[model samples]
Target: MARTALALREAESAAGRLRSELAAGDEAATRSAGSRLAEQADVARRHSDGWGFAALTHLPVVGDDVDAVRRVARSVDVLGADALPPALGVLETVRGGGLRSEDGGIRLDTLASVSGPVTEAHDASTRADRAVAGVRSDRLVGPLSGPVADLQQQVQELDRSLGAAEKAVELLPAMLGAGDRREYLLVVQNNAEIRSTGGLPGSLSVLRAEDGRVELGKQGNASLFGLSADPVARLTPDEVDLYGRNVALDLRDTNLIPDFPRAASLMARFAEQRGQQVDGVVSVDPVTLAEVLRATGPVEAGGVRLDADNAPRLLLNEPYQRLRSNEEQDAYFQEVSRGILDALLSGQGDQLELVRVLSQAAQQRRFLVWSDSDDEQRRIEDTPIAAALPRDEGISPSVGLYLNDSTRAKIQYYLRYDADIRSLGCTAAGRQQVVAEMELRSDVPDDVARLTEFVTGDGTYARKGDDAMNLRLYAPTEGRLQALTVDGEPAGIKVGQDGDRQVSVLPLTLRPGESVRVRALFETRPGQIGDPSLQWTPSMEWGPTRATARNLCG
Candidate 1:
């Protein structure tokens, strides 16, 4: 028992050091720590396998405790022998700059080589988590019990980290085009000009990748493929009524679908009309781009040096003033897109930092991808990168509140919004009641009325300087709105149903420095406390600020 405990302590110590080394980008130290961890884990496994220890599981009263220890010992051994090594190997390759080769192509062969090991690591880590959970703390006693529990929790966390790392390694190759040359429509969404999924598809870039080399192809403004006045595909009554009569018009209205797969298909169809055959769509808002820039350093595009701090402003808003005509602005947009892609593919930046930033963006739903390949799509199906609203009844169901500029102008750049949801309690009928609030503020300067027509609209849809917005609030598929109020008064907004969600739309106008608050009460059909997640349009200067609610079911 003493030897087993000592081995666990040494193994945990090594894991902590390994994590620290990885974070600090010290490849040599990380490899050393991984080796030490494996040695300590072997020691623990051998000590735990003693004949006397195995017999303890057959003894009365303490049998379960002994079994729990045995489980944890096996888990640690598997983690050290099968999991950490493969994960460490991948990290080592990434740190050594093997993700991208000298010619700026991804190292596909190297990535594919690690996929088997990483997948195995993931499976082993999952088993480790089960083993740890099977431990029964009640049977343990005194000082040893506390230490054992702590060790169990530590091991669980380590397993989870390994699982995440392995998933990333296994997913990247397919995403970057492993077997065949892949073509995808890259949407550079401008949140300043709000749309459903995120923002207006201000510009589009074609991303082509083969083996491991990625190249950015032709780039153009979304408007270049002029709106197909008629629906490219059939639209539901609710979609037509809420979005418009034509599906083409809703190509920029992605958030309306909530499900990225449907949205990507529509966007792809729109691209097809303009002679672009894309296998999938990848969307990124300015905030996501800024996060990437934070890792890749500053990039020069159209004679402007864009860094993390000013990327949103320059990319989303400043174009209106920097260029004199819409044509010039479109060209500039293409140039910026090309420059950013060049910077990324040049492999001059910190690869680890890029991975970390992109992972965080995916977790936040800032970067989304949809592929036509069944296998590729399957890998990201449940992940945030898929950008699908959750429909699980037992888990937290998600609610989305999104905005689109009705004025057909770039005025959304001056808009800011905050959203929050609170759980009230479960109803007697087993439904969950939730209160959602969204506050929007327009900070456009009074002088903005004098700006060019490009900054405002043609003044037909709305006044030149005022902000006109169509706000859509969505409830879980099994949920319904109980009541709604705008600015302290009952609002008579249009309510409709789309897919499995209940939708409420409010059209409003806000002048410079004006703010409006909209609130609603809703109930989800039994067995669910709404997942505390609130989705909104990604903004240039302001991303959606959110507040979560406690689980009322508990």
Candidate 2:
């Protein structure tokens, strides 16, 4: 027992030193420390897995503690022995040129060299994560709980990082035009006029990549073009039944559906019909562009000064009030987007910082990528940026509460949206009851009627300052909604299906200074004991500043 404890302590200390050595670019020291760390971890694992020590794991009260020790030792073993070497290799190769050559293009050889290493690290980390997750949370208490929980968190983070690296190594080559030139449609979703998947496809640009370098091309806005005569692509029956055919015919509403890849495909088809060649679709909101600004600093483009702080307002609301005509506003927004895209292509920032900011944006659903190629798309599945609607997947079932603005104006800019989901405990069979709640308030100014006619709806869809929004709540895959209420009163609900998942829809009209809270009580399927989360649409603000869900499964 003493030997095992000593070995684990030494192993952790050595691992910390190994990280420091690698960060300092001391390759020789890193390799030497890496061997020591692995050796110590193996020693601990051997002690824990030995027959004499394993015997305690079957003794009722001590069994949980012994098993916990065994899991921890094994977790550290895989991480040090299997995950560390490849991870070190990837870090070394990527650090060689900072992921970019002197020509401002990716180095294909560097990418190829890291792919195998990243994959090996990903697999090893995944196994380690599973082992840590198996710690008996119900039985492990007090001091044991804290370290085990911390280890679980660390392993989970490592798993996600390694998984992302593996995907990047496989996908970046083709996307960066390793051997072939690839053209992708860059669709900027505008949040002022809210749609389900972020917002309307307001600004459009084409990204051309050849020989590992990216270039901007063909800028326009959806408002500058008219709707298609025929559907851009055939929609699934459920999609049509839930979102209406306008999701396909109208260029702006193409993303009304929550399925991002499906939405990207429709927009890609629209671009293709207009004589544009597209290999994939990249989606970003102004908030994501603002994230890019973190490294690029402030940009002066198209008669506007844009920085990280004022980007959301400048891009989503200010234009509608400042520009004289729709054409002028569309042009202005497109130019702002082009400026940001150009700065990104020019690599005008620290490479590591840029990747971090972009990654954060992807987690918030402000940035997304979808490829038309099945193989490439598969690489992105299970990633934060995939942005696909949730289907029931074992323990972690998904719930959604998306919002869409029906008023044909920028009134949604003043709409503050938030959600709160509370887990109401589980049944004998493990079916969990949950209450999903959302509050939508109109923060429109008192003198909203005095605003520019263009900013307010031209009174065509609804009152000038009124917001017509459809709040859709989705039950977990294979789950069902039990009851729903609006402002503590029963309201008419339209229930529909988006694939196998059931959806409850509510329409609301909020005048200036008014607010409404909607609540949906639902239950999960049996054996669904996973923590719950609420997925919602991003409004003018891309990040979640409000609580979305609460887990009460204590």
Candidate 3:
């Protein structure tokens, strides 16, 4: 047992070194680390497969965890000995620009040839996921519990990433239009007037991908999808009740639902109605554009220079300052987005960096995507790019706090958020006690009332420069909201269920430099809980500082 434990520890450490060496492009160090990892993992695997360890694995409570460890040792052995070489070879090919053709289009042949390693890595991860699936961390014995749970969670995350990567490899050729043409709506979400997903669909352009090359098509603004007498598409009673009819009637409010897939569906339908047939929908906020600019150097948009430094401010805050009306703002947004889009499609900078920033953007929910093809969507549904609302399927329950601007102003550009969710304790049966506190601050000048009229919305709903937004807090699935308070006083919230999760909402306006603090007491459900989590609206400045506990029960 001691031998197996030490071997597994050494193997894990070696794997970390291997990863670091590979990232640093140190071939010799990576090969040495891989050899050490393989040896240690083999030792652990052989020892854990012995009769004594096999019998120990059948013991109660700890047995499953023991079996999980054995499976992990086997996977590490396989990964180190078999998977790493091909994966590294594939990585070398990609880094050498082996996938790009002379015309800047992706070479379908090269992509297909390199996918062998991805398939192997993906299959290994799938096996690991299955081996560690359904591990009940709550039932484990002391000290042993944390490590087992952490390893299990890591395996799950790795599986998700690999699965998404494999699927992308499979779908990339077709999606990139190897044989046929595909059109997609590239919507640039404006975070200045925040909506649930990221921002309002402030500007849009059609992109045509054919023969692996991409080209920009016609450009338009939100006004293209004129408001319909009725909703452009059907809506659930809950969606309308929570948000309002405008969520459906207006294209700009489609994202008010907070679910990217749902919002993209509506946007797609609206586009088809407005005379555009798209194979998919893609959305990115200005913050993501800023990240892209970091790789692309400076881009010229509307006779203005936009780089990583000024893109966010110019896209999110400047339009309201310089452009007077919605049409003018829309035009400015289009010009800027169009320029950035052109730059991205121009293939001017380090393509690898562009891919990295875009991937990070998707992970942060600043970029979202949806495909009309069911098979394509299925391949990505579990990935971050979908940016769907939190479902009950994940290992650890998630909490979401979404805000939608209702003040008819661009004041949300100056808003920032903070959240705290701490574990108080839990019942023996697995019910958890938690307190979630949230705060939203207005970072405007004291003379907010004297700000631009476009930003203030003329104080029709609240004081000038005050942002009146509908804020919603969601508890984990099957959890109950025990108490709610605003500032220091007890307050009532309009509570409803989004699926099994309880969602509470309220609307308020905050003056410049004013902040609103909300506290909610929750009795989380009788189920598995891992590390704490919190999700909020993606902002330009981010500014989402969250405090969470490592363990749900203490």
Candidate 4:
């Protein structure tokens, strides 16, 4: 009862602190502080409640047990105010004697406690059922509050109770019918026997690293086995008498490693699925299964399908090896397979339609340039194989190019591989080829600005491993402008700048192995008085020298 009261107080204090912290500023400090405080508060409350219940088993009177349970239940009601009201009301209906009894025999109430080993285990089972029931109702309301919270609260209670009950049940059988029996107690201790260690023991065991101590029957054996005295000794009844408990080795602490329970559960599940008998493990009680179905939902058999009624149990007496039960498997299957099936199927269907539309847009943007090396400058210039293809609406695509000089020796160009598709149907592999080697250019007027944009790969650019592109800018007025600036951030290239005009070169040297993207931004004042228009032409100079129209949009 004291533990229960302490848990209630701690929970209340935590709630108050949480409310206050939430009302404070939403800064990182406040958020982290609030989270830590909430976690501490919850830990305190849970420990208080869990240890309080454990202490309740020591109660001498029946009235004390009832009072303690009621106190804990009331605290739960307070903590779970958003959910406990409706569940409490339901429990109250069956609280009275004979209210739920169908016949003269003993009948289980929705919420009732029973004494003794089996009865305590049953109590745990009942609480678990109550939790599942609360979760179901919480789902119906589309809110995981009130009843949902209550269910979660009940689960914690059941978890502790079940653990305690299982321990008591396992240990009780060993102690039962032992009428002052005293056998030869041999206490052989060695450091080598230690296998897996965790929790505080893992840390504290470091202190014992000195000389690897071994003791036998309270005697240190330094020369027993001839191999540095492998410790072995016989413990007399008188020497073991120091242990206050009637049991053997009461001084030794029990290892609370989590792997033991998990391994046991898995082994039990395997045995059940394989139709083998397993002893001293928690078997899936058929009665518990019925209660689970009543509180939760339909059950599934095998890995196939679910049935609303006639649920199957993955018992320790089955044909196949199972890691989890039918109920657990079913729950996990629903949880993991929620949206994945639709995503894969829909993505496959959209791939075909995207390829056709992009091909048509490629043809229109294809152009030829005049080469300076040959005497006839109008001679056929270099063009990609994809660009020279005949115009076929179902098979061709257009390509557009824009360039800006970013450095003294190089330039960057923005290439658009524009394709009109209603959806993203092209697979990543299918869209890879066309996106590479597409020309990109800037819309800005100033050469320096366009160069800056290209160097930074700003505005818009394709993220592809494609063939190289070349960039060049013509700036006759201003010799070589200062470095480019993209959105006011400096790029590396240095160029010359004058009023309303700027130019910067770029490193648009695309080798066979290198992949590159170019961006450019232009910033200039309006044209001078009587000037027809202020023009800045950023050109791409690689296989083809095509100048892009700049400042036209402005």
* Model 4 agreement with the true structure over 357-402: per-residue lDDT tens digits: 1111111111111111233211221121011211112211212222
Worst lDDT 10-window in candidate 1? 541-550
Candidate 4 Cα RMSD after full superposition onto the native fold (Å): 36.5
Report the poorest 10 consecutive residues by lDDT, candidate 2: 545-554
The better-scoring model by lDDT among 1 and 2 is: 2
- TM-score between candidate 4 and the true structure: 0.18
Scored against the true structure, residue 415 in model 2 reaches a CA lDDT of 86
The whole-model lDDT of each prediction reads 0.74, 0.78, 0.76, 0.26
Candidate 3: minimum summed lDDT over ten consecutive residues — where? 542-551
Error of 4 at 1 (Å): 32
TM-score of 3: 0.84
RMSD after CA superposition, every candidate: 6.1, 4.7, 4.2, 36.5
What does candidate 1's lDDT look like per residue over 152-248, in tens digits? Answer: 6566556655555566667777767778678889888777677776777778888898777888887778675537776666777877777766555
Q: Residue 286 of candidate 2: its Cα lDDT?
A: 84
The number of the candidate with the highest lDDT is 2
Give the alpha carbon lDDT tens digit for every residue of 1-554 in model 3: 66766786677667668755654445668788889988998998898798987998888856876676677678777767666677577667765777677676777888799788888977876776676565555555554355445545555655665566677788888888888899998888888888888787888788899877888898888777646776777777777778787777778888888778988988888888888899999898888898899877899888799999988888878778777787887778788888888888877676656655765676678878799999888878878888888675554656777888878878888888767777766779887777778788999777774568777777677678787888788888888788888898888679887777788897767888889898887777787465556677887674332233555564
Model 1 residue 525 CA deviation (Å) reads: 0.5
Off by over 4 Å in 3: 1-79, 129-155, 393-396, 418-439, 447-450, 487-489, 514-517, 524-534, 542-554
